[model samples]
Target: MSRQIQSRSYLIPIHLDENHWSLLVFNINSKQIINFDSLYNIDKNIAIISNLISILSKYVTVLKGAQNWNFFQNYSAPRQSGDIDCGVFVCQYANEVHSILNMKQFDIICFCETKIEDSYPNSFYKNDYYYKIRLDRSRHGGGLIIFIKNSFVLTKSVHPENTELIYLQFRKSGQLNNFIYTFRAPNLKEQLFLEKLEDFIHSINLNEPLFIVGNLNMDFSDKIKSNISKFADHNDLINFVKTPTSI
Candidate 1:
């Protein structure tokens, strides 16, 4: 199986019992065995993961070279809301993981009653992307991640030391130099959110071709909209979208 698939990672789905489904991923490049069990904790599944690793190591040791396997039970895979949904979550997570690893931009946001924990579905894994920046606060309902193409030669120019804002500088070969900022403010405290963001924008090189985007979460009637405009005017940036993104 290792020789057949020349990928650094492989997602293997297995049916455990009549109703339960789980996933096992072999990350050969990282020498890690990533196990995903929706119903069980990491410690509970370590034995199963260890046994599987031992069996596979025999066939792969000769073809893929010898290495020690590190067991990682993904507690981040979605917990099943119902017994039947485990299979569905596993399929979706696997697809998302494969897409992100292969560098296909998947913009669809999947929401469910169960919290999704796998980093691949969120495109958080540093795979084939050349330059990636992530400002993650999964608990706070605010996070931003950017993936630059591996073909692009990027030089970090304006990375802020703050997590609330994502400011990156990149220069693509034979392409115009660009500055990108992805912003996501708090839903409730709009005043302080814009103030900090405005301060951040003031500190960066705004004269270049700048692309600023994110889930600002600011309503047209909200006072934060006015502050956003004020900041835009001060920095000569344009606010192109006015419609409410959510229904």
Candidate 2:
């Protein structure tokens, strides 16, 4: 017996015969029933969720409203290290799903010249709802950090060697890749900086959207003074900052 629920998505916790716990996230819009199991026991977990979905499909309301709903087991979900922690993993997975469904306005945040030390503990700026990536200054007076909403899955984080830049790749619910680059130029070596920056830009895939941000110490108004403009033109990057950020 299924009751009609009027929600865009549903989160259901499943107990595996009182031994293990898992989560089922059903999105009515996508018609996807995703299983997040800490154990990653595909055969057993899929069987359980499939049985539940089959039962739900038998309901007149669900059958009429959503037909041929697909079931997917998330293999990338964090697995529990111990046998007794499946319950905790289930709760965390449910919370993550909740955050994804009700996301905030800002998905990505970047900071340059953060002056953060390598030894600095992440807990100082850690937000439970966001993923934090930090790059400490190599010499002095240069550091970078980025915070992305946990709702968006982080596919990769790339930090180029001998450079003050960090590139992060993210995806939202199986969407296309999103690349974000954060950089801060050193006070000296202007030519070397541009050359290295150009190399980094050349490495990126232009088909996907790439956001390059940070304090480059260049005035965008002056094309010659700001060598970045040339690189931007070469790489087909646009400067969204129309107004002067500094005098």
TM-score of each: 0.48, 0.53
lDDT, candidates in the order shown: 0.56, 0.68
Model 1 poorest ten-residue lDDT run:
107-116
What does candidate 2 score on TM? 0.53
User: Would you list the clashing residue pairs of candidate 1?
Assistant: 76-117
Clashing pairs counted in every model: 1, 0
Score residue 23 of candidate 1 by CA lDDT: 80
**Highest lDDT among the candidates is held by which one?**
2
Error of 1 at 23 (Å): 19
Candidate 1 per-residue C-alpha lDDT over 113-164 given as tens digits, one digit per residue, 9 for 90 to 100? 1222334354445466445555544431344556566665666645466535
Task: Score candidate 1 by lDDT.
Answer: 0.56
